[model samples]
Target chain A: MDTVHYLLEGFGTALLPINILFAFIGVLIGTAVGVLPGIGPMSGVALLIPVTASMTGGMDPAAAATSSIILLAGVYYGAMYGGSTTSILLNTPGESSSVVTTLDGYQLARQGRAGSALAIAAIGSFCAGIVSLIGLALLAKPLSEVALKFGPAEYFSLMLLGLAAVSGLAGNSMTKAGIMTIFGLLLSTIGLDNVSGVARFTYNIPALYGGLEFLTVAVGLFALGEVFKTILHKESHDGNLAKVGKILPSKQELKESSGPIARGSLLGFFVGVLPGAGATLASFFSYIMEKKISKTPEKFGKGTIAGVAAPESANNAASGGAMIPLLTLGIPGSGTTAILMGALIMYNIQPGPLLFQDHPGVAWGLIASMFIGNVMLLILNMPLVKVFAKIIETPPKYLIPIIIAISVFGVYAVQVNTFDLILLIICGLAGYYLASNDFPLAPLVLGLVLGPMIENNMRRALTASNGDFMVFLEKPISLAFIVIAVLWIVIPFVLKLKGKKVLINEEA
Target chain B: MSKTFDRYASFIFFIVGMAFMIESGRISHSAYGSNVGPNVFPFLLGLILGLLSIKLFIETMKYQNERKEKEALDYKKFLIILVAAILYALLLEPLGYIISTFLFLLVGFQTIEKGGWVKTVLISASFSFGVYYLFAEVLKGTLPGLPAWFSS
Candidate 1:
């Protein structure tokens, strides 16, 4: 009942003309970028930040915040909507969250059901969006309180658990996953110290003081690196990518997808609310879960609608779910949310236990905008997908160089610092290395954002405890997280040893 | 699987980390509490990285299986992209934002794409101008500039 009242308040703010307009614009641009390969929500937001900042004065600060949140949410869904297009048409996923879609989506394209594949993906995402939003509305406050009780050790332990889970679940050797995670941690340690306020690895260059920007690393590794690797290969195809089939899913497809969509929404919301996790992992887990449960598991990765529906829905739901932690507590559940946190801080609106009480307008207004934005995304993306498809066919030659120019200029524009440009290049090089080695970039990014918080919390905790380490164990919430962390490592190892035969079978 | 690669990564990172530790150690701030200093985290992180490299070395040695050797690293397209990026980085200061970006994008597109001169030029110009107008005029960002002529 309280949730209903708060949400109604949020809706009242969202219904304002300016908020609605921004929500529409956010979904519009989000769909456009989401449809294109090599662009993710992070880049979309980074590219538009300067633009979004321009609109700050036109609306109230609270309303303007809703616009930004709506835009980001739009990008999130737009990316989900557009993700399957490439997977079905080109056998490529625009983002990691879309990888599952590529399996059945590509197969569906091969079977000349491209239109049906896309329609189902869109529909699944819409369902997930609504369900996740409801979950967010209900769970955000309670979870925030839970998040508030965590100290530095608990946060670091949570990160450790995240790294382990990523390695355990990543589609590679455990040793390889461990190495990649460690490598990311090392990367995060670069630049000035967050707690000590001392420069660490600037190498006498002033620009390095800020450390490597995640945007530079992400864009270089995912977008530019992809172009570099694929430039020479001529992907031989048999025909014009399967022409749009029926624009709506068949009754059979709908029946197949309904169950996966529901399960995915629930799973995605839970993952999103957990700190250090995000939509990418949610989608991956949803696909694996669906595959594990399906009666006709063999049909997976071969045009099964459920295979596409599960992950697509999960990823979208996770996007909303992640906001729960970020808004209620100051903790970010994922890397994208971490960036959003940075944006919020830039606006001087600190999000924490008091955020709701201090600024209900910003909190509820942003929440309301997300609800409206999801509808905007569904309406905008489902019909105009062909236009986005055309964007996919755009030659890389034109896009790649422009991307480079923008990245170089964008970093420079922030401060007119020649040194920052150098730092960006160095980060780009590091990104290229990490990508070539199949390291998960998200952990390193999250570490960069959370490192200071963890460090400060540790200092504060120790000061309160007078050097006693037992403070971590004394707190029920922290102890619970520690137990979870311990189980995270042990469960995976035990499962691996016991299921060696199962692993072999899956590999084959 | 080569010692060379592991050694190379470790050696580079170790040197970088040590340099950071030394610099931060000289700073007047503490790291954790009154006893712990700011250099503690960097030094610890560096030490762990060094140890991890040694472990990586041992693991690489255990993989004696003669996997298929990879092709020589392609440095052609990579070089073009790198050079273009370097040029953009270098030229960004003197020429200001719009003109420098437009010229850089033009050359970079042609160098990489090879034959799309007209499309590259137009697209490059439009992209630079659009970013400039959006950031500078619309956003009121203090975008660096030379003269008003570069605006067109």
Candidate 2:
């Protein structure tokens, strides 16, 4: 593709020795934070941003911004690698996105295959990351064109489809998913109502006027929630330290994983590009795809290499895919990308349709750095797997307090609001309970992030159409997405009632 | 145990969602006069969520009827963690970041984890100082300072 040439320019900038080193450091720190369980990319980046900003002294603002972007990407992927280690070793998922990894990952660890599990996760992620980066290089421009064609109705329908797709999140019932999605929309309403400027649910708090903080919700749900859950269970794993079994995949395992990884990457990327759907959905769909296609379908949840490869590959690929909408349009496809959007704003760079013409360096540099950052993550993760897993075993007694304190400090640093600190705790507790009974946190995060955009766009569409009620249905792309959303809700119920168990029968 | 948790949670969701719809309805009176208001979408969403929650509660009961009752939950342990979180939030402002954080870790480790004093103290102290340095010094994040006696 002609666009690949542009990516090469980006690669040149990203490969500069200084940029490479920063990318490596970002991945290393991201992995360490991820291993701690509950510390997500947002908090990870927020804490690190201060240091990066201070140290980038003499670099041009553009190059400095690129460095930070590369660093952030490193943390994003590095967290993925770190998240899996904890999920596999301790059954505690570091992020909501890693929840599915825990189902088979910890089971494999219990079966004395922790080394193999960790190795496959790293290797699978590498393969997926490389392929997705290539896909991004080749596909971004065309995909952006596809994105530009979408009208407000289409965007709204796409979000609805994304919301409905949550019904299939592993372990959550359809109704619970529905309720969770609604809960997210409600949280999104806490700030000012964009059209009227009337406060919907602020209850007089000024912090509430800006609405729920994304970092607060993310840190609380992933990290504090984990802490609360850990304390509740009051259970600790007796370190059996699974005997150093084979770390490398067997030939058969390698053959098995290749098909799953390839398919998962494609499936995950498309799903990731959907508005509001994210890596979590991509992981779910990828797992379902593997089970659907597997010849020996019964080996799925029983420490199967294919099972791990599918979701792991999908999520990494989806990370690349999620960037498409955010970069091409002003639309954010996932919670993480929403945060990335905020970072772009802080750097005074606007990412939208004209971004390519306005600031090609920022766009291309970000895409190019993803490729280098993935490699950096792979190298950073493998050697540190054992050491990282040890941190997971660190007792919560000491761990939780430190994380909570950091979370508080991190929030306070952003706007220096004491109220946000309090809000963080309240939201964290609510998130903890919601997660405990299987209310997936992703939708809430997604809704809160995308809520304003959805509302603003809908109003614009309505006004543009002169109060035509059917304008949402009038656009072709919009209608297609609405139909897809309807199918997402309807199809699953039909499948469940027919006893068409889509879940692969795993070997016990 | 799983079914009980599922059912109870859904029932609570049902009630809260209903409450939200009613509350939105009450506040949306003026918007209703204007034919639409800020609360319109939320009101409808709340109603949909309420209905779904009730349906899910029923489904959870059905599942429970089909399966065996789960073992009793270990609520005692969960309560300790909950209390610790509540305490951390309460004390963070009054006690200052470093001192409160160190004490919070000590209590959680010593009481909840039942770790030894030496282990608890060392871990707690290191963690408090590590975060303080990372955020305050390295990252330039604004953190609450300790009393004059403690800073020296």
Number of the top lDDT candidate: 2
Report the C-alpha lDDT of model 1 over B57-124, residue by residue, as the tens digit.
56557555665567566567667777777777877767777788888887777766688678777887
The C-alpha local distance difference test score for the whole of candidate 2 amounts to 0.70
Q: Cα deviation of A53 in candidate 2 (Å)?
A: 9.2
Docking class of 2: acceptable
The lDDT per prediction is 0.67, 0.70
Residue-wise C-alpha lDDT for candidate 2, range A1-508, written one tens digit per residue = 5686777788788888888888888888878877775466655664555446544535777777778777877777777667777778877777656777877887888888877878888888888777777776676777666766777777677666655654344234667767776777777777777677778766787778877766666666655665666666554655544443557667877787888888888887776766556677678778887888888788778878777888888877877787777787765655566566656655666666666667677778888777777777776666667777667666666666666666655565665666776677777777777776667665666565666666656656766676575888888788887788787667767888998864310100
RMSD score of candidate 2 (Å): 5.2
| Best candidate according to DockQ | 1
Angstrom error of the Cα, residue B81, model 2: value is 4.2
Interface RMSDs of the predictions, in order, are 3.8, 4.1
lDDT of 1 by residue, A1-508 (tens): 8777888988988888877887788777776666666567766665555456555645666656666666656665666667767777777776667877888888888888888888878888888889878887777777666756666667655545544554454433444444545545556556676666666555676656776655455444444444454442322223355566667778998999999999998998888776545777788789999999999999998789888889888988888887876788766655567667656654667776567777777787888778788777677666876777777776666766777776776566554667666656666666556545544444455555555555556666665776576878887767776788677556666877787521210000
